[model samples]
Target: MALIEIERVCRLFEDPKRGKPVIALDNVNVRVERNEFLCLLGPSGCGKSTLLNMIAGFDHPSSGTVKVGGHVVSEPGADRGVVFQQANLMPWLPVWENVAFHLKMTGAPKAERRERAQKFIDMVGLRGFENHYPSELSGGMNQRVGIARALLMNPEVILMDEPFGALDEQTKMDMHAELVRIWRESQSTIVFVTHSIEEALALGTHVAVMSARPGRIRELLPIDLDRPRDTTSAQFNDYKRHILHLLRPESEHRLEQAA
Candidate 1:
C-alpha cells in the first residue's frame, strides 16, 4: 500500500462573511510513497497548506479520506512530525530544550533527549548552538532548530508548510542543500508545501501541482535529475517550463471548469 494515501478528499469551511461554505479542496487524490520527497506546489490560495494539514492530521476532510501508514488520520499523532513556516520556538527555552520538547512532554529522561537532540542538531548543521535561545539565533538558524525538533521525533512522515519561504534566496539555497542531505541521511518521507516552483524543482523527487482555490491535483511529474540538480540544464529548464505551463491562469481556469 502507498505510505500516505489521500482519496477524493474535500474540505469545506463556513465562510462567515459570505454566509456560505467555501470549498478548499475538491475531490483530491494523491498517494505518497515511502521516503520520497514529494513537493506540493501551486499558486497561493490553492489549499496547499490545507491539503498538507489533512496529511498531518491537523484538520479533517469534509468528505472522503486521508490515510498515513495505512491508518486513517483522525487527529494529530506523534507518527507525523511537522515543521511550520515559522520556527514556532519558545523564546525562553534554549535551542536544545526546544528541539527535545516532544521528549520532555512524553516524560523521557533528560539525558536521552539531549543525546537524540544533539544527533539531529548536527544533522541540520546546528551543532554549536544547542544552549542558545531562539532569540539569539538568526531566522535561518531558528528554522534549523525547528527541523531538528521534527527529526528527533523519527516519525514515519514529515509535513512542512513552506518552511523556507521567508528566508533570503542564498539562505534558502543553503537550507535546500541541508534539507536534501538530512533527508538522504535519515531516509524520511516528506510532503513539503511550497509556492516556489524553483524550490520544488530543487528539492523534490516528485512535484505535484495543484489548481487554484478549491484545489485539485493537476499533475504529478517525477524528477529524475541527478543530485545537486543544475538549474541551468536544458532538461531542468524543460521541466520548469512544463510546470509553468501547468500553473498558468488559462490552464487553472480550464481546470475549474472541468471540475
Candidate 2:
C-alpha cells in the first residue's frame, strides 16, 4: 500500500485584484510508497510547493483526498515532518535542544529528549556539534540540524521544500549525499520539492514533474541510476533532455541558440 496518497486534489487562491479564485492546482494525483524518495519537480509557480503543503497539512485541498499512512491529513501532525528552505532553528538554542524542540513541546523530560536527539544528531553527522548554537554553525551544518530535528520525530514521511536550495553548489552536493545515506539508513519515505532537475535526478527514486500553472502531474519517471549519480552519463543526459523539454516552452528553447 502507498504511504502517501494524493487524489484529485486541487487548490484555489483568492486573487485580490481579479476578485476571483485563481486555480493553483487542478485534478492532480500522486502516491508515494514507503521508503521511496520521491521528488516533486517543476518550474516556479507550478504549485509543487502547494502540493507538498497539502501533504504536510499546512494547507487543505479545495477538493479531493490526501492520505498518509491510511489517514486523511487534516492538519500538521507528528507523523509528517517538514524541512523548509531555511533551517528555522531557534537562534538561542544549541543544536541538540533545537533538534529536540518537538520533544520539549510535548513535555518530554530533558534527559530523554537529549538522549533521543543525540541519536539523530549523530545520524545527520552533527554529533560533536550538538552543543553549538545555530548562529555558530555554517549554512550546511544548520540545515543538518533542521534535518536532524525532523528525523528525531521518526515520522513515517519527511517533507522537504527545497531544503538545500539556499546552499552553495558544493555544500548542496554534499548534503545530497548525506540525505540519501540517511534515507537509506532510516527507511523513511521522503517527498522533496525542488525546481532543480539535476537535484531531483540525483536524489529521487522517482521524479514527479508538475505542469505549468493550474498544476497537474505532467509525468512520473522512475530513476534507475546508481548511487552518487553521474550527471554527465548518457542516461543522465537523456533524462535531463526529456525533463527540460517538459519544463520549457518550445519557443524559449529554440531561442537558446540565438542567445
Candidate 3:
C-alpha cells in the first residue's frame, strides 16, 4: 500500500462577505509511496498548504479521506511530524532541549531525552550548536533544529510547509543538500509545499503541479534528474518550462487560443 493516500478530497470554507461557500480544494487525489520526497508546487493561493495540513491532521477534508499507513487521519499523531515555515522554537530553551521538547512533555528522563535527541541533532548537522539558544542561531540553523525535532520523533512521515522560504539563497541551497542527506539517512516520507519551481526541482523526487484555487493536481511529474541536480541543464529547464506551462492561467491560454 502507498504510505500516504489522499483520495478525492475536497475542502470548502464559508465566505460570509461573498454570501457563499468558497471551494479551496476540489476532488484532489494523490498517493505517496514510502521514502518519496514529494513537492506540492503551485502559484499563490493554490491550497498546497491546505493539503499539507490535511496530511498532518491539523485539518480535515470536507469530503473523502486522507490515510497514512492504511489508517484514516483524524488528529495529530506521533506517526507524522510537521515542520512549519518558521522554526517556532522557544527562545529560552537551548537547541537540545527544544529538539527534545516532545520527549520532555511525555515525562521522559532528561538523560534519555538528551541521548535520543543527539542522534537527530547530529543527523541535521547541529551537533556543535546543541547548547545554543534559538536567539543565538541563524534562520537556517533554527530551521535545522526544527527538522531535528521532527526527526527525533522517528515518525514515518514528515510534512513541511515552505520551511526554507525565509532563508537566504545560499543558506537555502545548503539546507536543501542537508535535507536530502537527512531524508536519505532517515528513510522518511516527506510532503513539502512550495511555490518556487526551482526549489521543487532542486528537492523533490516527484513534483505535484497544482492549479490555482480551487486547487487540483494538474500533473504529478516524476523528477528523474540525478542528485545534486543541475538547475541549468537542458533537462531541468525542460521540466521547469513544462511546470510553468501547467501553471499558466486559463485566461491566458484562452487569449493565446484567440490569437
Candidate 4:
C-alpha cells in the first residue's frame, strides 16, 4: 500500500490586484510507497515546491487531500520533517543544539537531546564540529546539520526541497552519496524535489515528472538502477535520456492533451 497519497489535489493563489487567481497545481495525484525515495522533477515554476509544502502540512490545498500512513495531514507535526532549500539553522545555536531543537521544544532533557543529536551529527560526518555555530560551518556542512536536525525527529516521512541546490557540483555529488547512505541507514520514506534530472535519477527509486504551469504529473517512472549509481555508465545515460524526453515541453503537452 502507498505510504502517502495525494488525490485530486489543487492549489490556487489569488491575485487580488489583477482580480484573478493563479493556478499552481491542477488535479495532482500521486502515491509514495514505504521507504521509497521519490523525486518530484519539473521545470521552474511548475509547483513542485508548492506541492511539497502541502504534503509537509506547511500549506493547504484548495481541493483534495494529502494522507500520510493512512492519516490525513492537517497540520505540521513531528512525524514529518522538512529540510528546505536553505539550511535554515538558527544562528544563535550550535550544531548539536540545532539538531536537537525539536526535541528541546518537546521538553527532552539537555543531556538526552545532546546524546541523540550527536549520533546523527556523527552520522552526517560532522563528528568534531558539534559545538560550531551555523555561521562557522561551510554550506555543505550546514546542510548536513539540517539533515541531521530532521533525522533527530525520527520522522516517518522526510521532505526535502532541493536541499543541495545551492551547493557546487562537487559538493552536490558528495551530498548525494551521503544522502543515499543516510537513507539506507534510516529507512525513511523521502520525498525530494529537484530540477536536475541527474539528481533525481541518482537519489530516487521513483521519479515523478511534473508539467509546466498548473502542474500535473506527466509521468511516474520507476528507476531500477543499482545503489551508488554510476552516472558515466551506459545504462545510466539510457535512463537519463528517457527521463529527459519526458520532461520536454512538447512531450508534456502531448500527454496532457491525451489525458
Per-residue lDDT over 130-217 for candidate 3, one digit per residue giving the tens place of the 0 to 100 score: 9999999999999999999999999999999999999999999999999999999999999999999999999999999999999999
In model 3, pairs of residues that clash are none
The reply for model 1, stretches above 4 Å from the true place, is 251-259
Q: What is the lDDT of candidate 1?
A: 0.93
Question: In order, what lDDT does every prediction score?
Answer: 0.93, 0.94, 0.96, 0.94
Q: For residues 31-115, write the lDDT of model 4, one tens digit per residue.
A: 9998999999999999999999988998999999999989888999888999999999999999999999998999999999999
Q: 4 in model 3: Cα distance from truth in Å? A: 0.7
Which digits, one per residue and each the tens of the lDDT, describe model 2 over residues 189-246?
Answer: 9999999999999999999988888898988999999988998999999999999887
Ten residues in a row with the worst lDDT in model 1?
248-257
Taking all chains together, each candidate's TM-score versus the true structure is 0.95, 0.95, 0.98, 0.95
How many clashes show up in model 3?
0
- In candidate 4, the residue pairs with backbone N, CA or C atoms under 3 Å apart (3 or more residues apart, or in different chains) clash, namely none
lDDT of 1 by residue, 75-179 (tens): 998889999999999999999999999999999999998998999889999878899998889999999999999989899899999999899999999999999
**Best candidate according to TM-score:** 3
